[model samples]
Target: MKKTIIVLLTQLVLGLACADTIQLETGSFVTITLPSGWSANLNTSRSNEKVYWINLISPEKNENAGKIALDRLKHGWAATEEKFIEHMSASIERLSASLKEQPVSLNELKTDNAIILYQVLVWEKIVSMITGAGLAEYKGVGVIHIRYNSGHTAMITVPIKTLDNSNELNEILNIAQNMQISMPLSENKEEESAQSSIQITQNEHGTVIGNPDISRVSLLLPSKNYKATPGALAIGRGDPGYFIGRDMVANVIMSGWFSPIYKFKYKTARDLWKKDTPKQAKNLEYLKIKEWDVMVHELEIPIKTQNTLQVTLRANLLEDGTWIDLRLSSMGIASQRADMRKALIDYINTLQVNVAEARGFHLKYTKQGVIINAPAETPGSLFIKTKSLLLQKRKTHIKTEFFLFQDSGEDIKVIAWLRPASDYHYANVKTLWDETRATLSGEGFTVIGDTDCQKTRNWDVMLYDLKTGDKRTRNVNMRASCVSGGIWVDVHFTTVDQRDSSFLRSKLLAYLKNFKVSDSHVE
Candidate 1:
């Protein structure tokens, strides 16, 4: 009796191993075996139509459900593979068009035709019946589709999940790629012919857009096409230079004054006194508008293709902590009114801005300034201003300004500030400094100089403590006097606390390490 019991236990273990170890590999010949408790039923109707056979199989609990599905498909279509694919495509197109909603852009395509198989997984449940007795129920179901034709086929299985996680969905795709199909059906010549009858095309383009999801309007151009200069405004100018494509030209501008508020005020004064234009007030809302500092991008695309083609694309970012605003303006001959409207809508829909993976900062834009709120423990804050210009039929100019503030709120830090030499003719240095003082005062920094720093050819750095309104200056430097055509400014800060000092130092180092010169002029 003891020997018999041990032998039975060994058989049970062997059965469990066999069930888990089953793998099917199909290339030219088809052979598959179901695990224990699973069964297969073959359909023999269209056995001669190049396709070998159709089978319905499932675990014991789901056998009935699988049979019912097989019955439905068998009754519906007795056509060749080519006809079936046409029917399927037509059905999908009809359903999509009937809804009268924008269809999801189907941008990628792959085809395989080596083997085809169908699988269904069912989850059973026990529920109380109307008669008060427990009844068996089919709670959920998932489908597995396998297709093979012309030496290629895909075996994809959907898992049972209450909610789908895209990351997990990708894992499922990986598993499908790894699955071995045991019985390779004869090449489906009909399927190949059907695929040849259909033509698919894909178009991809990159542009800058505002991603409201992450806040902040940012430049979302392709990573390969542009490089970022982190600290200096002159460095940031390189991005616009690199933004070149067929029939496209881009320019960059960087300006710095005591504050954007004051910059606007100066512009307002010039527009009022010099130009005598009321439009200056409207310009104030967009230009010299504060919120986190702004970066503006302008893209011009000329549609040359005769056939209307759908374009789908996304920007790959090289850095974090910046927001994106994308705008598109069309130039040249072909159908400007309609094409511009369509391009604008597509550009707007494609905008997506989120914290860069390196830094999880949420960028906010307001009329005051561009505000960057870093995740907890982040070392600093960034305020930016961005504006744009489109020059006639061929040129695009983007201007950006950045203001770096220490997250500690203790010491004041000024990064690079660049101002165009040509613009100095119109600039009001006194009002700019006064406006900067007023803004800093609200942030707890007391203004020191009564005269304009720009007039003295010197820039001031102001610091304040939250506990008291007392203000102090760590350093004052001459303006970009060394700067010839364009200016470059760099602000260095040392925190009062040693611990905070290390954090600030580390951030500066990181910024320098990641900074790269933009290659915009390369032909």
Candidate 2:
């Protein structure tokens, strides 16, 4: 079985390199650039039964069929239109319990030798789902299951999976990229609600969106100020990273993107931001933003024959102890710089929690902050926002989402995430301070100054001033001690430029001295 799977994988890889177009085994051709080979593995149990799994199983074609075509998705599809839906439903459930019973659409394409039945089901997979046989990550999965037989021939099964992070945006892009039916696609798709009728639901996964069912973090924009990023997706795994709702209008654009910390992809949000910053914009300055201290860079790129300027801002925030790097991009010309900057600041300031409307969590942050212990209401219930004051202790409590912190009030406005000790790994205070500065410098933020002192034998204090703005200075204070088991209590503070650091210095020590870690478990 292993050998057989290897042979098939090798063939697929070769076919991908040799065949620009995909010729389905059923004798139909579809056009797409060559996809790399598939990943295959064989699993055998104690019994004689063996299962072979192939991943990315895209490249294939038959001697008769030139390449993969919608016309070839005609095997089991024709016989089991109803049964196919049942299977798709079951498969969706397997992907994530949060996914709704999304609507399924079926279309048929007739070719010379065979009739292809393609089932296009739009649903969300908040939690990523992986499958055997070369099918990879699927989030807002468009489970395209094709099955049909030419009456005299045996039935065929061709399943394709796509991972989409946003629903409406992705659905529209998917239709443009994949809807190749001879019939007018808009006519059939209109029978169902447009992608604009989007809905969001929370589950074990962090966030999810529907109307094509892909998982994403969403935020509401000021009606006239901004809109969802406008563009078209180009085939395959279109783009990576889950963007909430990025809006780009005319010359000015506001967008937000995030990277998960648990992936161990980066040390902190700052590190994540720095790593993502383009190489062209080096020597950027770190400044104090409304929510968190951010590193800002300005760059100019040529779009078509015209020149466009873009300013990128990056910051670090912790959600439920999960480290997340957040980014905001301003695009247009330097002439609109001041307008876009003010608008960007206003937009971030207005971000509030509106989950009911499928909006994102925008918490407010300031120099004077609180150390909150967000207790859970239920024993094992998962909470994204930090709120509960009562202690929640459970033997099996595991955090399923990032730790979210907002300003104190009913209308929670998020500014920053105070990452727990678990997210940061530092041997000592000096190492933490020095490494942080190195990282900031690498990300283009100039380390204005650094201070380290051992006031007492009990603990050591460290400070770094990353002041990029002419009006303010963003300072971070770290007090590390062996008592907390090599733990560092990092307090972020901002002060008006040229003001004596005396006030902020005292505030930092006070915040660190008076803070405590909560139950230390995810609610």
Candidate 3:
């Protein structure tokens, strides 16, 4: 299906960024220069043409100050600074109407360099009422607008908390100066329709491999070939998949491979693709794709039928140790086997990857915590909670950051608590756990076997997988660690339903594989 057109635009969003800067595209009017460790996400799309919301992200681990959105508006170029500022004030007012809090103060700027007209707004914040006193902890909200030619305007904003100052907004604006507008990507619907063409011609010839010259990843098709069924990229939803073809009649197994893994370099392409394969596969041989060395595998049996199919896959290693694997199958029909094999062989021989040089992945800023290369996650719904709380007292402080993501109809949670190691007088993790175990549960928590306590990235660490609570309460799967005198962090997931224990436990373990605390996030 033409399922991937709009979706493909953002697939390469975080890949291959270079030279101390990351690029961000709104898929609308602007693409901006994002400094390293900084990320901006599209917040809301408005029917007002080019008007939209882009969130400014904080690099801090658990800065849940709520969303700070920059309003972008496109209009006719302002004849004077006065006109620009007036336009900006009106835009802010229209946006502010939907907000719980209203703008209380607005100011215009007179600058030495007058290429851009500017305005900044300070807003009254809504307070959370407690017993009798309101939690007036919010400092206020600050917004700065920059109006430029081409009828373009952008703003940087934040809900300033008492602990954070106005300088936070200033620092953000200074960073904004480095941003350059990115040209809009073409939104031709034809690109979407073209993806479905791979499946159209079926019953007589082999699959029509996409053209090598015009395609993103190059390969050739037979002169008279059938089109395969529709498939999405296995790694992401609605992304283009490798065309699957069998006997020109009906193909059972269809698949593709995607990698952001400059991380798992030495692993064979079979090693990567096998993870998503429906049936167990066995490594078969190693061969050469032109000058590149490739590994091969044969799927044991992908689909069950008397009419059997033989599927063999080959992958080539790129210069940087990355891999691109091609999977082709031969049907049980004797005549079709040779035709499919010959077509696939010719296609494989001509395969060429024309992607950007691989770079390590980027970090995504979720509302509660930052994700280290996690894919599109719709967090904080009824099924999840992206709640983050920062607590402080006379001498103790703790930041409890929660990221709850559900997969396979089960809730998976990561609750991270960050505290200064000095709270425990810089005690070894074993001692701290021995002491804190009593505080978390009346029954006491169990320490998983051979708890790992190793220093990594300047954090002296300790880890214990703990479990406690009875059938009446949720189960806790937790890890506790200390970074010498700097901080102690605990990450864990609590199962919501008692019946989900085993399934949740296994999923939690798999989920933990992607969980990481960025060293920059450590206080």
TM-score rank, highest first? 2, 3, 1
Q: Tens digits of per-residue lDDT for model 1 on 403-513?
A: 333221122223433233333442444444455557657876443332223321232322222221212212221111212323322233322221232343343333332
Error of 3 at 69 (Å): 47
Candidate 1, residue 516: the lDDT equals 20
Q: Of the candidates shown, which would achieve the greatest TM-score relative to the real structure?
A: 2
lDDT of model number 3: 0.38
* Model 2 TM-score relative to the real fold: 0.30
Q: How does candidate 2 score on lDDT?
A: 0.34
lDDT of 1 at 312: 16
TM-score of 1: 0.19
- TM-score: the better of candidates 1 and 2: 2
Please report, in order, the local distance difference test score of every candidate based on alpha carbons. Answer: 0.27, 0.34, 0.38
Query: Which residue runs of candidate 2 sit more than 4 Å off their true CA positions?
Result: 1-226, 229-241, 244-261, 303-305, 321-325, 334-343, 353-523
TM-scores for all candidates: the values are 0.19, 0.30, 0.26
